[model samples]
Target: MAATASRSASPNTPGQQLFQALRRDTVGGALLLLAAAVALIWANSPASAEYFAIRDIELGYEPWHLRLSIGQWAADGLLAVFFFLVGIELKAEFTRGDLRRLRTAVVPIAAAAGGVLVPALICAAFLLTRPELLRGWAIPTATDIAFAVAVLAIVGSHLPKALRLFLLTLAAVDDLLAITIIAIFYTETIAVLPLAAALGVVIVYGLIASRFRRFFVDRAWAAWVVLLPLGLAAWALMHASGVHATIAGVLLGFTIPAVVGRASNRTTDADLGPSSQGGDGSGIDLAEALEHRIRPLSAGFAVPVFAFFAAGVDIGGSHGLAAAFTHPLTYGIMAALIVGKPVGILASTWLATRFTAGLDPSLRWADLTGVGLLAGIGFTVSLLVAELSFTAGSVEHDVAKVAVLSASLLSAAIAAFILTLRNAHHRRESQE
Candidate 1:
């Protein structure tokens, strides 16, 4: 009976199986860290020249301004895959998950807002004297969900499930805000024709996915054959539009329907994953299906590759290290990420609990604090913003990268310490 139940509980499809493995926070986080480490080591090694040579090698059609460096391809192309997964998750939360209800969603939403605003304000304050450096204010505002989840998985085993839910919802909202900032502030210019074409393609893509969700869901290869090309077209057009191609990924993700048919008796809990459990009745769930299929590719390959290309910053020497640390821009980002993120998140969460809903009964203030500090480990999107904020290879750019790296490390260590202690306390309480 046990073996039969175990087999019955397994993921139903190959895509679902792969998604289960890749979605493990540790797997994705380890790959990202490994890639970033390789890039950092290579950039500072004897073969540093070769590293930059490969990264700078460019190829693409010149007519559409698609030609770009290897690094640029990782940033502008592969990262779109990552953002696409993010979009699916965001839509799921809004449509069926915690964010669906005002009562359940207020805390994370308010906390995310505080997280973004406080960090930006703190960073901006530090860069006030140097107005030129203010463009990078958003650099410290992002929360790397993969990294935070990985850390939590390691140290938060005894923590309440509510804490994990809070973190995931908070990060989702944080990603949405980061996307908005990129679409608005980072886009310096736009080509109206390409932008319009991109939107049109996105609409068509949405229509196909919604209208023919069963078609794609029934045949696993259908999405790859049909929607993949359309998604790429939208991404390409959006790229040409100069609106940041990753935005195309999010827009495309938003179009997929979260719930397909009305609640039916046949749909099992396992079919819809954890989020769509009680309420949805499990119609096709195209959004969840597509997310599972593509997430492995995004988390396993695309994000790590982007990290490798983006994290290869060269510090000249001991002198350069000192200079980067002392530079106003670097320290400013460090302060904002390490200090502001926690203060803002904690303050906002407290205020929300006071007025709206209280913290989960199983949770304590310390757990929230640890999650806030963990959020300070901003890597993926932070690096992207750092890239966009300053010229490549410029002093400000390198300094900003260094600051993000340093601050993230410090934040992770501190959060780990606090959470480890909390985990112990919880374990002891359970035993008692």
Candidate 2:
């Protein structure tokens, strides 16, 4: 969705756009959790063999290295759709939202860096002796934006705008870092010709998107008919190139024009409400339109399906559970998520605000502490990264998944507790 400028004269605020987006994400996040739970239960049940069989089913063309298991499809293909939404959101924020201003954006960006760095270091520390498990150091560095925001929507509705915006900005930057890590660190091998082909297709796609922006924006089905093939071709080429295919989604998302086609002055439908922006050729922008059309598929289907396929780690009965707990991978990820994340966020925020004089007096350190805890809820992205870090069906892979799930749950609980107390304090202060 298009984020309104913070300085806009319109009644619609950036907060409103974020709230609306988070509302949709909340529903998706709940569904994601439910799907994960089901997968976990099914994998551990009597019919666990069937679950593994379905996940291991391969159904792609053998040529071009496209033949992959069901789980691989969910991770490498469907998850790209989810990342596309992230790319759109990132572009929108930079182009139109609070992030448009460097002054407004620096705190969260710095905090996000700290959040990433500390967890990675903490994970490294725990896995120092176990070099094999160290690949998962990036697992806890991400924040599940949907799940964290959904928790805030439920528990921190009465809290100040500063806290909500802080969380949003931090999570957005966190996603960018995760994408960077996946693109840079995790890539194993590169096939030069296919990579070049993918880049060429993406460039052509960008030209087509920019040229036909108005046409595609006007005709909702045009993207599916024309753009989908181009996108699929790009994705296929990228997959062949041995880069994580999901990066293609981010690249494609960056190409979409943030504004509508040739609209000299665009007013969001959000700004004027339904009656004003619709019906006439001046309603929503192309970026917003794409978000609305694609988010349902991304959040509702892509994410949950990926979770269902990915989260079915067989933690190997009681013996496996005990071994996992003793494993460095498990301890590293848990420590990173539960401890390292908050410490990093808080320290970074403190340093930024201290040196820059940008702190809002009304917002206490406690408020940020709660937000930091929420940042620890690194579920969906963590699972994807874990799969990337270790071979599928390996012991390290299973332990890492279990660690991510456990750490996410623990982080969510801690965040809820902290924010609830903060919410009560804020309510009491307002009353007084």
All models: lDDT? 0.87, 0.83
Query: What is the Cα-based lDDT of residue 2 in candidate 1?
Result: 40
Q: In model 1, which range of ten residues has the least summed lDDT?
A: 260-269
User: Which tens-of-lDDT digit does each residue in 241-306 have in candidate 1?
Assistant: 999999899899999989833342222234334332224334667887788667778888999999
Pairs of residues clashing in candidate 1: none
For model 1 the TM-score comes to: 0.92
Alpha-carbon deviation at 213 in model 1, angstroms: 1.5
Query: What does candidate 2's lDDT look like per residue over 242-323, in tens digits?
Result: 8889889988887776753323343333432222133444433567667766876776688889999989989879998899
